[model samples]
Target: MTRTYRTLDVPVRGGDLRVGVWEDGTPGAPTVVAVHGVTASHLAWQLVAEALPGVRIVAPDLRGRGRSNELSGPAGMAAHADDLAAVFAHLDIPAGLVVGHSMGAFVSLAFAHRHPGLLARLLLVDGGLPLATPPGLSGDELVAAILGPTAERLSMRFPDVAAYLALWRAHPAFAADWTPELEEYLAYDLVPDGGGSLRPATSYRTTLEDTVDLNTGTAVTDALAALGHPTRFLTVPRGLQNEAPGLYSPEHAARLVATYPAVRHERWDDLNHYTVVMSEPGARGVAAVIREELSALG
Candidate 1:
């Protein structure tokens, strides 16, 4: 069954936050709130939504990303978390499961910690745990190290959406698994810059600030120690570039699991970080886990 996809702009601190809602349209179905990665928008989760026809999914383009790119400063995990809390209040969803990918996981973590009454369950897809920061690295250095060349693309100019798609089509991580759904996800990232060029909807300053916050900020670190609800962490063996050992290296992963014994951990060696929720096999895996969590809730 083809589900219904709707777009809405929920009010936030400085401006309205864009949200994509995918639902089976069945009243009273289990609803899950999803959060996208740092540089990604809500469209990134469409594949996972398609795999769960009986579920209702809501995803937001965080402040300074996607349609919310127009939003001003005050971007960080705390601000983003508060904005998510507001999103829930605006939608009247007092409590629901939240699944976050990459940076979104941190935002979800902060949200759950600050507004525990709003989140019933939490699932972190390849993120949420405090990253093991290498010593002697500055914030910019850390961002460059973690994001690699993927971060460089944020400053590039594309002639148009087609050109951007071509760039992604050539990417080793996405070329083999590109789909119309993925195309939409990528295309939505483009916003027109003057002179007939385009750039990603995510702002560089926002990305930089967020990188600093997640890696060095207090919200996530403070929340990690106080996570009282049942939480799950899902990780991939490869990263944004399809590089091995992925985000949260083996040592870091093990340390996090040991430190937070209450949080469950699952690892997928075959799936890269991006494909873990953006491809057919990946979406199926993510949706299945979501279904399992939902069942467990009942």
Candidate 2:
């Protein structure tokens, strides 16, 4: 399919926020608004978008990330969700499927809660459920584990985009699954910081705040329980490489299914949190689940 890109500026809480949209398939076809995870931009949906023919796919760079970094806001889930709502209103897209991955899952949940009538279905790709942090783990410690690489990268001034892309390609998380699509997705996350240096578009402060929000799971879990729309939760079997077991386990996912009887839960055994949405195979699996769910909804 031939894909087209466009920029959208929608009014939000404090000011206007920019959204990068990838439009493909048919104009009047059912739309799927994809929300990417923390530290990721709209490009994260590239593989999924390519697989879903006959559907209008819209993936937006959330506030403080990608082209929307300049967008003023609180840099929390509610703020991101509100930004999505604004986009829907501006485009006059009513009642379409909502798909979210990781932090994007939280944003999707929040949107479903705030604007119940606006979503036809909600599909969470290995995220959106409550995650349990070790009780003794301090917020700072958690942030360090999660944002350490980003901090290190943002501190160094990359000589050029190629240099930055080289570093990303060598990263362990993506070492085995690197592809041209993944390269383009990573590129979207980079921006010229200053002095002819490139840096990630997401700010350290926003990254930390997003971490705290995910660790707490306050808004997301509550929103899931309250959401009236049909919802699907996809869980990754392998936890973070450095973390203890049960951090994001199948048991936890089962409990979530029990709590929200309306939620359809599934687990992908071979993928980790990052790979679940980053690789072609993982993205294809997620797309299949989404297709099934949306078909059932129809």
Candidate 3:
């Protein structure tokens, strides 16, 4: 089924935040606010919204990414969480389900921490729990270590969307999972830079700041400790580059679930970090989880 898509600029602290809303024109439909990864736009949730035909999905381009790239402010888990609060207010979403991917998972946890009353529950995808990082790494080193070429691409300029698409087309993570939806998502990520070139809309500085904070800051840790909502954490077997042992190894994921006790854990052995929501199969799996969670709410 085809869903209607619309964009709205929401008033936020530094500037207007661009929000994407998708729905099937159902009256009084259940609403979910989805959050993308650190360097992603609202378009990242496109497939998931498509899979969820009658549900309304509201996703935002977080500050310093997508159309919200120019918003001035320090980017961190806490700041992103507060921005989410504003999103909930702007839409009058008193209590809503949330789904966060990658760094967005961390932001969702912070949102649950700061604005618990606004959230019904959480669906944290491939993130939310603290990552195991090497000891005593600087911010840049940490970003470089975790994000690798993904972070480095923020500094590079593309001649056009095709060039940018070409980069991901060759990525191991998307090689077998490539789809036109991925192309559309990647194209929306580009904005014009000076000198007739285009760069990714996500700010490298913001990405670095967020990466450091999620890995080192107290916000996520605090949120995990005080987690009061029903949260489900899904893990992928492959990492960002389609490498083995993705974000969390089985033992590590089990350990996190054991530690948190409140968060339910599941693993998708065939999917990787990026494909967990970007591909059709992945989106369908996520949508199934969302449907189950929504049913549970009723």
Candidate 4:
């Protein structure tokens, strides 16, 4: 089924938020608010949108990425959660399902904690559980370790969008699975950096702030402790670079499940952090899980 893709700017406290709405031209379908990863835009969920036909997908370019880059932010999990709530309010969503990927999952947890009555069910893809940091790493080291190339690419400059594509083509994550959707998502990430160059719109500083808070601060921690919404969590064995063990190691994931009994965790060995929602098979798997979770709730 061909989906209608519409871009809109929803007014928030900081300013307007750029959102991507995908649906089958149906007016009253169930809405799923999708929040993207730390440095990613809403387009990251294209495959998921396509896989879930008839579902109204509301994906927002969070505070400092894509077109929302201009919004001056007090950026963090709670802040992004508030921004999502604002989008839901503007769309007249009293209570809805939310699908969050990577850091977006943490934001969703914060959202559920802050706005308890607004979320009926929650899905966390490749993240949201408390991350187990190595003992020796400090702030910058930990951020660099966690994000790797996803963080490094922000400061790099390219002569053209094609050059940026070339770099992404070489990336371990998208090398084999590159699709038109993924290409468009990468293309939308670029903004002019002067000198006939292009750079990612994701603010490095803002990403750093979010990384610190979500990893160590009280907002997400406190929220996780009190998260009462029925939640589904999916994770992969690979990291952003398509390397093994991903964000949550097997041991860490085990600890997480033991700690948060409400979060139903599942693992897909074939997918990575980026591929879990962006790629075809991964999206279909997630969409099925979402459908099953929703159906079970009824």
Tens-place lDDT per residue, model 4, 1-298, is: 5688999999987789999999887666788899999999999999988888878889999999999998975899888989998998888875868889999999999999999888889999988888888766666887898998788889999898899999989989976788999999999999998678999999788899899888878998898888888898888999999988989888899989999998899888888999898889888898898778657656
Residue 12 of candidate 3: its Cα lDDT?
89
Candidate 2 stretches with Cα past 4 Å from truth are: 25-27, 136-138, 145-154, 239-247
Q: Write the per-residue lDDT of candidate 1 for residues 90-201, one digit (tens) a residue.
A: 8887586899999999999999899999978999999999877787778779889888877889999999889999999888788578889999999999999877899998
The collision pairs in model 4 are: none
Candidate 3, 75-180: lDDT as tens digits: 8988899899998899987596999999999999999999999989999999989887888999999988888889989989999888998898889999899888
What is the C-alpha local distance difference test score of candidate 3? Answer: 0.91
Candidate 4's TM-score reads: 0.97
Q: After TM-score superposition, what is the CA distance of residue 156 in candidate 4 from its true location, in Å?
A: 0.8
TM-scores, all candidates, are 0.97, 0.90, 0.98, 0.97
Question: Taking the candidates one at a time, how many backbone clashes does each contain?
Answer: 0, 0, 0, 0
**What is every candidate's alpha-carbon RMSD to the true fold?**
1.1, 2.4, 1.0, 1.3
Pairs of residues clashing in candidate 3: none
lDDT value, residue 191 of candidate 3:
93
Best by lDDT: 3
Candidate 1 CA-lDDT value: 0.90
Show where candidate 3 strays beyond 4 Å. Answer: none
User: Which candidate do you rate higher for lDDT, 2 or 4?
Assistant: 4
